[model samples]
Target chain A: MSRALGIEARDRRRAMLLTAPALVWTLVFFVLPFALMAAISLWQATATGMIRTWSLDNYTAFFTRPAYLGAALNSIEITVTVTVLSVLLAYPMAWIIAEEVPRRYQRLALTLAVIPFWTSYIVRSYAWSLVLSRKGVVNDWLAGWGLPLLDLANSRAAVVIGFTHFFTMLLVLTIYASLVQLPPNLRRAAADLGAGPVAIFRHVVLPLTLPGVMVGAFLTFALCIGDYVTPQILGGGKDLALPQLVMLQVGRRADLPMASALSIVLMALVTLAYLAMARWMKEPGK
Target chain B: MIRFAVSATYMALIYAFIFLPVYVLVLFSFQDGRFPIPPFKGFSLRWHQAVLSDGHLMAALGHSFVVAVLSSAVSLLLGFLAARGLAHARLRGAGVARGLITAPLSVSYLVIGLGLLASFNLANVPLSLMTVTLGHVVINAPLCFAICASAMGAPQLAAERAARDLGAGEIRVMALVTAPMILPALVAAFLLSMTFSWDEFIIAFLLSRFDVTLPVELWSLLRSGLNPKTNAIGSLVFLVSAFAVLAAELALRRRA
Candidate 1:
């Protein structure tokens, strides 16, 4: 009995050693950050950049301020819009890439999906500004046709367009990963069972790829909600996104308490969304 | 037949949507226009000249390269160690450990940047290129851990057992047998670390006191308004990143 107990002890020590590095990193960086942010959120900042003792003033101020709450809602609204758009665009692309094509084009198609990702996120947003600007190519083309050129530059439309460009690739890539994992035989079996193409897709493919869809939604929404550059550049100072507001508080106002409050709220929201995604989609393989 | 035609047309539009911004960025790099605005006056090398002549831009580029290299090296080393440790041990807490390691990947950069400042004193740490690299290590190590852990999992047991049976020491087995098997994963992790470090804005922006990275510089430039010179630099960065990713992808596939 003593020998067995000793062996068990030894095994446990090895396990602890294996897990130590990751634990230490998370404790120092992630958890500690949250703890600090939470503390700061409950405090107030003075004119001289001095932080006062703990109070619920910042959170109270946040809750009471219409602009702050509005910024938070705008973030949610933008995230929902981007997620819906990305999923719609990605579904068909993933379908074509998974079901309609020969295997030879898989690598090429995947490469195409990833190439845009290699470009800088801010650069891409700025490029959309170029393409959608009133005097830009799209408007110029429309002008030649004697049609009224739509002003997409520096509006909520610009944010959507920029996000679509940036995020559609991610959705397509993720959905493709899940789609490829599915056995082709499932689709064939559905066909042989006399289901129509749409029915087979609805019953077999959609349910199977639901995990990917959820993951894609999580990625897009999480990113869109926290995005500062896109809203700042594309929304042209008119769009009052939470991340942009947080940056303003930090950089311009130098109000650490307000910034901390905003960061904590944003982090909590994203963490909740991520947990929901994990619950729905636990495709650990991809 | 009409359905087929419509689908084909849709595919073409999707392709155009994907590639159009890229084409515009690349094309505008060559245009003689002073701004991103059109008229396409003529082709010239003036923008390239401006990009090359700016010392600040060049300095930012250099800083970015240094951070990328340092972060990639450190993250890959630490990650490889963690992966080997986890693989060798009959661990009970591996799931919790893995969860902790991957948590950084999901956290937003704004929160991370804010958190780092709130947690640490800048006077002691004194944000610089060194601090920026440290921040990169903090954010990027988890990515390496995830990639290397999966890569090392299935194929490692054979090599480890073989080395032990051959009377090799633990370090010898790791350096010779385990390292070879996981080399591709190491490469992938390093490339990913490099990419993340190069592109990372928030942490670097928040932490840097003097030595700013290219992304931060480019962002500041944007606030000052766009120029042809910025386009020139943007195009160059896009080219380098795309090439690196392509090379890394090919190398990974070949090894597989």
Candidate 2:
């Protein structure tokens, strides 16, 4: 019995040795850094350096300042619009790939849908900028057609277009995973129950898939809200999003405290989103 | 019939939308004139050659490759060991350990970047490629852990046991038996991690001082001018990364 207990202890120690590196890594790089950020968020940014005073002055400034508040609002508006539009757009595509395509070709269809995602992300946004620039293809085509050309490169419309383009692919990937997992018998059962198509969809298919869709939507919100490049490249400097605002604090202003505070605000928004979506995120009790 | 037609047309249009920017980016990279816009003067490889020759862009590409490869290697190692450990020992609080490793995935890159920026400043660690690589590992290790952990099932565990019972050392069992058992997950995690670290922007942007990743350099290049050169570099990166993706898919398919 003693020998057995000794062997068990040795195994336990070995396991700790194996896992300790990653656990320590997370604690040092992720958790500790986050703690430092939260601590710095309360400190004051001064011309010389950060003042050691523990106060919410930076947070207060974020609330009171129009530039900061406007940027946060812009972030919220754009994120919501993109998430909604992406779901609406991607659902049809995902549905088509899952339902309309032949069995053997579905994989090809999905791969084709996801192929563009492999492009360097910044280049993807820059590509959109080129497509929508005033002197770019759309406008050139418009001029040839004698239609009024749009100056879209530096606008909210452009930012939304860029984000929606990316997130639609993401949502399709997620939503399709859930859609494919759905057992076909459930639908057949509903059909045999004398239910019409709409009735079957509303009662059976929608309920089963809504949770998965919500999860994807939550992912969209989390990703869309925190993105800097999409808005930075597409929105231009005309409209600053929250991330751009945070970068402004760090880059031009060299205000690390202010940047930290803005980062906390961004995280707060994500935490709130996670809380709202917590219902769908729970695993089914097995 | 009507529904099928509508769906077909819709799929066609969506595919068009998806490929539009890629098409235009490639097309205009060959624009003979300075402008990358329409009225495609003619085809020329001048801009691609320009990117190939530009010293800064080339250096940034090298930096990106180093960061991606090194960071992914580290991430995969740490992740695989952790997955192996968790799967082997019935240790208390293993759930919490798993959660801690995966928590970073839920956080945004901006938050992670800003947090690291603050930490480096507080610790007086100078921003450099080292710091950027560290941040990439943080973001990517969690992904690798999830992939590896999911692939570690009863079959792999039983195989490990069999190897151990045959008097194989712990390290030997892990290297020779368990790893080969779940090679697909390791390959997937490594490639996925590499791709992510390769394309990661905000962290590399905020962490590095003199040396920057390709995306950050592309960002500055885009900001510096609106020219065909940017299009050229962007197309180059896209094609290279796309090939990596296709190769990854083929590898995984054949392995499966």
Tens-digit per-residue lDDT, A40-129, candidate 2: 989988897898899989999999999899999999999999999999999989989999999899999988987788888898988899
Minimum summed lDDT over a 10-residue window in model 2 chain A is located at A277-286
lDDT of 2 by residue, B1-256 (tens): 9999999999998888888889888899999999888889999999999999999999999999999999999999999999989988899999999999999999999999999988888889999999999999999999989989988889887887888889999999999998898888888888888889989999999999998999999989986767899989988888878877776677667766
lDDT value, residue A41 of candidate 2: 89
Q: List the residue pairs that clash in candidate 1.
A: none
Docking class of 2: high
- The CA-based lDDT of model 2 is what? 0.90
lDDT of 1 by residue, B1-256 (tens): 7856766676667778888888787778778877866766778888888888899999999999999999889887767777777766667767777777778788888888888877766235677888788789888888888888888766687777777778987678878988888788788788878988888887888878888999989888887666677678888888888877877787588777
Q: What share of the true interface contacts does each candidate keep?
A: 0.55, 0.88
- Compute the lDDT of residue A46 as modeled in candidate 2: 89
lDDT of each: 0.81, 0.90
Candidate 2's C-alpha runs over 4 A off are A280-286
Best by DockQ: 2
